[model samples]
Target: MSLLTVRNLNVNFAQRQQPIEALLDINFSIEPGERLAIVGESGAGKSLLGAAITQLLPKPGYIASGSVTLRGKELTQLSPKQWQEVRGQRIAMIFQDLMMTLNPVLSIGAQMVEAIRSHTRIGYKDARKMAIEKLAQVRIASPSQRFEQYPHELSGGMRQRVIIAIVLLLRPELIIADEPTTALDVTIQAEILQLLKEVCESHGVALIFISHDFGVVARISERTLVMYAGKIVEQGATLEIINDPQHPYTQGLLNALPQMALPGQRLNQITGNMPSPSERPSGCAFHPRCRYATERCSQEIPSFINTDVSIAACILLEELVSHEEEPDV
Candidate 1:
């Protein structure tokens, strides 16, 4: 059975003028020990999806439709107290901003002790020992001394590591990591990703890693979901999507990636900005920027078409592939 299942989920925010649809019919599932990555541009609802799963959406934003189930229990219907029990215990999260997640005034040891004690009834001494062990697990140097330091005293990478350590100490069944390495250097980012992958693998923890960087997603995820304007446009095994993207939007994003070519070669870029929530076009949200868009594409939404290892919400895949394989015109 899937560890976490999100079906036909929709999230909306109320505004003075109109209701902003933040997520529309989002659907996906993560199997036990599976590492899934949700990749998209900014405003693609990646972070919003994470918040929805954790039941942490801000006021005025609410789940308008569908269900979120973790271990066969419906999360949406859970009471506040039930949510508290499920959140840090069964489903922990490593938020996007480490500094925001950490308490600036509290020592790392204090926060870690609290997290460890929150779910399990443990004495301060036992919790402190677990905290130190977790800090070492995330590769924090001089874990003993570092545990006594405040968030401000630690470097950016160290702080991120600490946040990760806390989540791992919980040993939750599922973890929703929202851009966990956003604030770290490239080298540190690699280390963090590696640590997360190792932990999830060893503990059979399901991971939903959300990020806008395809390279980062490709590195740590076995499966990938490409989201656009709050909906999934393409999804499949990471290798399949990366090597053979079918959706026009996915193709455009892959094209926009910087290449290690000659200095004079121009880099590819996707033209056109994403539409605002209030001004989202009818039919396919990506129609305006899609190169293969037809008259029908602008008038009707395309259904997801399965392609063995991948699924794409595009009307022109077959034609596009046929044309690509054709000889010179």
Candidate 2:
């Protein structure tokens, strides 16, 4: 059975009584022990998807439509009290900001123990033991000593380790990690990514990784979804999307990778910025920035169509296939 399912999900912001659709008909699913990455430029709603799933949408913004289901349970219809049961127990979120996950006044042990005891009926002593175990599982040296230290006392990497340890305390079934390694140094970033993958695999936890870095996604996730302006432009196996991107946006993202260029050469970059939610275009969100865009693309939104490898939202799949005889662009 699927671990999680999202169908026709929509999010909107009420701006001066006008509804600005932030996320439009989003849909996807993840299987048990699968790692799926959601990649896109900032403001493309990568983080919003995570927030929506956890019922953490910011003020003035709400889920406009659709459902979020986990193991056949409709999360959208659940009461706040019921959602409280699901959040941080069945499904946990590791936020981008470590500070947000840790309380400033609380020591790492205190914060972790609170998280554990909130969901489970364990005493403080048992919860502390569980926290130390998770810390060790994430490869933290001297887990007991680290537990007594405060969040500010640790380095960026150590702080992240504590954050991961806290989430894994209950061994949740699913984890939503939104740019969890973005703030760390390159070496630390790689280590954390690997640690997350290893820990999740050992525990059979499904992961939804939100990131804009294709390299990170390629290394840690088997499947990837490319988002643009709150919509999934393409989704498939990571290798398929990396080696053979179907949508123009996905193609552009892969092409813009630094590895795609020669040594010392200027890196490729996509032209134009992702449109703001208030300033979104009428039809296809990426049409204004796409080189392959035609008049039809600017006037009519594309439907998600199944290619041989990926399901892509693009009107020019036929044209792209016909021109497949030529070299890849």
Candidate 3:
């Protein structure tokens, strides 16, 4: 059985006039120890999807029609108390901002001990020991001294590592990490990604890694879901999506990636900006910005059509295939 399954998950918020759908019919499943990455530009609902899965949607946001299931148990039906039991113990989330997740006044030891006591019946001393071990697991030097320091005393990377340590300490079956390395430097980002991969592989943890950086997602994720304007436009193995993107939005995103070029060579960029959430286009949310969009694309939403290793929502798939069939340009 899949460890986590989210089907038709819709997160809506009440606006001045009507309810704005932040996420529209999101669907995916993760088997045990599987790593799935959700990649898209900002406001593409990647973070919102993570929040929805963990039942931590922001104020005025609620799940409208859908189900989030873990081990075949429906999470949407869980009461606040039941959700408390499930949140940190069975499912943990690593927020993008470590400072928001950590308490400024509490020492690392105190915070971790509290977390352990909340989930288990261990004594404070035992919990402290476990906390120290977890800090060490994340490769924090002088775990004992670091545990006694407050959040402000550590570096950004160190604070992030502490958050990760706490999340993995419980060994939750499913972890939702929302751009956990966004604030760190490139070297630290690589290290953190490696650590996350190792922890999930060794503990059978299903990970939903949410980020906008395709390069980071491509490095660690086996499967990639390309989201746009609150919907998934393309999904496939990481390599396939990077090498043979079917959707115009996906192609544009790839084209914008920084490439190794000769001196003075200008980098390509995706033209135009993403539409505001309230002003999303009618038929296809991306139609306004899609280079290959046609009348059909602007009038009718395309169904997700399977293409062997990938699935894409694009009316121009046939045209794309036919063009590829012709001789090299």
Give RMSD to native, each candidate.
Answer: 3.1, 3.2, 3.0
Candidate 2 lDDT over 210-277, as tens digits, reads 99899889989999999999999999999998988899998888888889999999888999999999
Best by lDDT: 2
Candidate 1 wrong stretches, greater than 4 Å: 16-18, 260-266, 318-329
lDDT per model vs. reference? 0.88, 0.90, 0.88
Order of candidate numbers by TM-score, starting with the best: 2, 3, 1
Model 2 ranges with Cα > 4 A deviation = 319-329
Per-residue CA lDDT of model 3 for 102-199, tens digit only, reads: 99999999999999998899998899999999999889999999999999999988998899899977878888899999999999899889989988
- TM per candidate comes to 0.94, 0.95, 0.94
Q: Is candidate 1 or candidate 2 better by lDDT?
A: 2
**Deviation (Å) of 20 in candidate 1:** 2.4
Which runs of model 3 end up more than 4 angstroms from their true locations?
260-263, 318-329
lDDT of 2 at 65: 96
